[model samples]
Target: METSAYLNAVVEQTNTLAGWVHGRDATAPVPTCPKWTLADLVDHVGATQRMVAMLVGERMTEPDSAYARYVPAPGDPAQWRDWLTGTAAEAEQAFASVTDDTPVWDPSGAAAGVPFWSRRLFGEACVHRADAAAALGLPYELAPELAVAAIEDWLDTLTSRGYWENRPDFADAMRGSGQTLHFHATDASGEWLARREPDRVVLERTHTKADITVRGPAADLLLVLSRRRPLSATPTLELHGDRTLIDRWIEHMDWVTGD
Candidate 1:
């Protein structure tokens, strides 16, 4: 997808999420994220969006110190929502002004340019939008292409340097099997196959099934793979081959790549 489209989707999803947060039914629990209430989920997502916007827009070298200055303290829900909406608007404007090829640091050493943040922010906002919706017992929807790309990004990010270093257990489990895991999106014809090797986890787009198969709508599959929503939560998912392998894969999956 084009960078403009992705950025636009981020803005749209953020706006939708804000509305959900302000709804009367906002007290509901987010089943996807067990420990957080709808309000807490909104605050968390808002804080994350603001932090990422700062990291990419200002080109900060150390994120913790810089991000801490802008983040809302715990229990400050109103302030947090205000910051989220304001920062999301700022991020939208900043991204809208740039071209896809504009130079940007690849904090993860994976890819460079504005497109990376465009895509990352898009997926981040989209998935959390689903989280907010699921929390409010509302329907979740995403652009087909965006959903597919989110899944791809999730897989790629999990195997990247940041995830491996932080989640050693996950990395070990991922490396335990020489077997591969395949994700097939039935609606959009999107596919991803990942193989574990000694040196690195290799991934590619292919139709062939691996040792396990995760088949469902692109959006549901994306949520399931992201661990934002459980597979059993959705009726449409079809798990072929070993269920335990799929569980292991999900247990080890990482959402974000960089520290």
Candidate 2:
């Protein structure tokens, strides 16, 4: 996806999230994030962007969450929208100011500049937007190309968390002698072969043989691989090859759940 598209997603998804919050009780529990309330998820989406803007936008050499704090207006949907708008604008401006080649600090050390953070934030907002829609019983969707970008960004982010965040639980689970997982999206031009290992995990952007392969639309694939949607409940999602391997990956792959 283009950088403009990602920034656009950040704006649009902010609207979707605000609608979900305005339509439902803020206290509604998010199935995707068991520990988070609907409001928490909403706040998370906005606050995270604000934080990113502080780090990447403001060119803060050191990251800090406190710089991005946004206090929501109580009982006013317009206020919520305003908050999202301002925060998202900050992020967009900062990202749009830089080129792809501009060096920036990324936790994973695998990404650089506006391209990495824009793509990363887009995926985060997309997934959490789905969470909001799921909680409110509203429908969710993403552009084909954007969805593919989200999935690819998600895998990269997950690998970063697994190896860098010191999530020993996830790190231990991701290791294997030579197991592979294939993510195939039927709706868009998306295919990935993930070679899992402890020392050096590789995410190949191609169609290759794997011990297990999960096939679905880009949106569903993102939810499933992120563990937000169950592989069993989604009929559109198909699983083939070694089920055990897929299960192992799904079970401990999510860092959010602290599994």
lDDT of every predicted structure (CA atoms): 0.72, 0.76
Best by lDDT: 2
Off by over 4 Å in 2: 65-78, 161-165, 257-259
TM-score of each: 0.85, 0.90
User: Considering summed lDDT, which 10 consecutive residues are worst modelled in model 1?
Assistant: 72-81
**Model 1 agreement with the true structure over 122-241: per-residue lDDT tens digits:** 778887888877767788888777799888767777777766776767777777547887888888869988888775677888978678888889998988888877778877888888
Error of 2 at 46 (Å): 0.8
Alpha-carbon error at 43 in model 2, in Å? Answer: 1.3
Candidate 1: segments with Cα more than 4 A from true spot = 23-28, 73-83, 97-107, 111-113, 254-259
Model 1 TM-score (2 dp)? 0.85
* Candidate 2 C-alpha lDDT tens digits along 1-259: 7888888888777766765576457778888788887767767778778778767765655454435455543454446666766778878888887777666666776556567788888888888788877777778888777788888888877766435456666766777777899999999999988888766567888988789999988988888888878888889988889999888888875655312
TM-score of model 2 vs. true structure:
0.90
